[model samples]
Target: MTETNDTANLIQEAEYFYQKIFAAPVPRPILEKYIAANRKKMPRPDERIRNLVLKKADIEAVEMAWRFKSPRNVLTKKIHILIYLAETTPENFSLFFNTKNKRFSSFIVLAGHFVRSMGKFLKGKFLLKRYNLV
Candidate 1:
């Protein structure tokens, strides 16, 4: 039983490391847009669009996380998240585009790509410096 638990932890740790190597934590609301879309029991018309409905859906349950949580998500929003997975090294991409003041108006919504990437970058840099790795 202990070994089984250890194996589970190892798997989770590997995934966590993979995610760090990929990008950052996704926001809660963005993940829900996906779950509500997939689950057969559709939220009510009014409940569907409410941010709170999406927020309550567990963010970590978003599948293929390394795909959706990486720099690739920022590039194409993950229609091809896996196609770019093996190449997701930070040196090969950037979330900090030169669009400091950029803005767009759209009726559509995108998932957690942005916040996840940015948060990952910031956290990685902080951890590196904190440990004198930099």
Candidate 2:
């Protein structure tokens, strides 16, 4: 029984680590947009064109429009999010980009985990002292 429990715990830990390596956390505001779109049943592509013909399109000045969310959604939202984050917060672009590339992203996440574990052992001191970043 104890061995079974240990194996289950290990499997859960591995699953969590896998998600941490591949997927990045979606922030609240962007998530809200998807939720709202889902709730409102936003107009379909054809309807959007009709609205344009009548000169009543939402955000007429903008080219790309928002989309409704569904269970089988594509990577469009993910790319949009990455682009938005990269533009707004250029410093963290590498982290955003890594989430797109499997190999590089895995390395970045593992390095982050290693640094965090080391920080705890070093009494919350600098994770990388050689950088001299206070």
Candidate 3:
């Protein structure tokens, strides 16, 4: 019963992440730029479902492919990594916000994410200020 509940929770969490990240339509400019750069087109709906099936391909390889893909969109890459990690390695994904882990490496990883998030937040703030929209 516990195993079943855990599986349900995992599925729920994965679905939540998928909806939040991938459901939104990409901005037109970014989509055009991505196409112009010839980066991997965002996976088709069926392709996404197929990739999530563990019986098909190794998830780590999938994760690494996204990781090394064009660095032109670091934020999107990071979110994709997070989604993959959430789907395949829930423990590791939890570690991104976990405070109980005493491991130095985990702390470093969390700190790195925090820094990146703050950087993006500040950048947006600056842009808003420049346009007098904030």
Candidate 4:
């Protein structure tokens, strides 16, 4: 069916976008500074993860939180976008909020990322360059 195909395409697009954000490197110094300032808020609270992050792991501490932590894994960079949409978008009204299903939650998160990233792109922000995602 056309609807099924559309959903599949959207999921594929979301996966691509997620991979781009995941693989994008954060500057070591910048990430370190963020960790230093925000360690109290970080999950896991493991000194080993902390040390690995300080040693410049491929992913930032925030990314590590997603890969290693639960419930918190549902939290992504575009959570603000999700909140905004839940508050404002009529089409998505009563949807995508407080979702417990990981798959649906991931879909909402990716949709949020897509919306925010598209907005930035429209504003002439070179996202890949700005985030060093390239």
Candidate 5:
């Protein structure tokens, strides 16, 4: 029972992530239909079912082709911190890589540096103006 619930949750999370990467609309109604019926089963693609993913084989092929880990894997914990600071969208995150590699990590670092510099500049300007009045 516990494993069933855990699998269901994993399927739900995977579907959500798939929605982010895919251009197709989510098959929420179809997923809900299966979830309601079995309550303990994950959705397996069938002709009648509206599969949110492209296909199982397609996903497997991509996984096999790119077995390499993401460059920012080292900063997994700080990733959220960087993402929160960056103005980038999820759609563009994968495309962020350049010839140098780890573009998103570089972008996050550059963004943090720029923000800190901008803050310092603003504070200096404010202090200069506020000194005579204060």
Candidate 6:
């Protein structure tokens, strides 16, 4: 019973983070502009249009807010990426939330992929340190 409850809590936490990261409401004007621009390029399916609009909105929001330079923003971005991966590819991330069949191998695989994905950000930090710029 305890294990089942733990799994439920883990799932809830994952969902909470997913919503927090991806559920921001993009302004209607931005959405309409993206839709119009995309339509001019080519008449694609609605799903594809939606994806492109959201991507653009996310980029614009980050840029407008000037979030790229802040350490806290970087950390939040990392967490968002991790949560997105876990939600999209549950097979790779399920072990952490599955209490009954927890395995070290699965954890290692997930960690490796995460580190690889984060390499660019980490490299920047390392370069700064190497040149005594940090």
Top model number, TM-score = 3
Candidate 6 residues lying further than 4 Å off, grouped into runs, are 1-69, 74-96, 120-134
Poorest lDDT segment (10 consecutive residues) of candidate 3? 42-51
Once superposed on the true structure, which residue ranges of model 4 sit more than 4 Å away at CA?
Answer: 1-101, 125-134
Estimate every model's Cα lDDT from 0 to 1: 0.35, 0.36, 0.41, 0.38, 0.38, 0.41
lDDT of 5 at 90: 49
Query: Tens digits of per-residue lDDT for model 5 on 1-134?
Result: 36475446435534543444344433554344434433333233222111213223232222212222333321121223223322144443554545566777988999997886556545544432343211
TM agreement with the true structure for every prediction: 0.22, 0.20, 0.26, 0.21, 0.21, 0.24
lDDT of 4 at 83: 34
- For residue 7, give model 1's deviation from the true position in Å: 18
Residue-level lDDT tens digits of model 3 in 1-134: 35454344334334443444445443334333433332344322222322344233233333333334433343344345444434444433543455574698877977997886656555544443343321
Q: What is the lDDT of residue 133 in candidate 2?
A: 18
Q: Higher-lDDT candidate among 1 and 6? A: 6
TM-score-wise, the better of 2 and 5 is 5
Identify the runs in model 3 with alpha carbons over 4 angstroms from their true place.
1-44, 48-55, 70-94, 100-134
Model 5 lDDT at residue 66? 24
List clashing residue pairs in candidate 1.
Answer: none
Error of 5 at 32 (Å): 17
Clash count for each candidate, listed in order shown:
0, 0, 0, 0, 0, 0
Steric clash pairs (candidate 3): none
lDDT of 1 by residue, 90-131 (tens): 444444233354344221223365666556555544543443
- Local accuracy of candidate 4 as per-residue lDDT tens digits, 1-134: 35454334333323333334434343334333333323334322333333322343323233433433332432233332223423454544435455455787789989997886555444322322333322
Error of 1 at 90 (Å): 25
TM-score of 1: 0.22
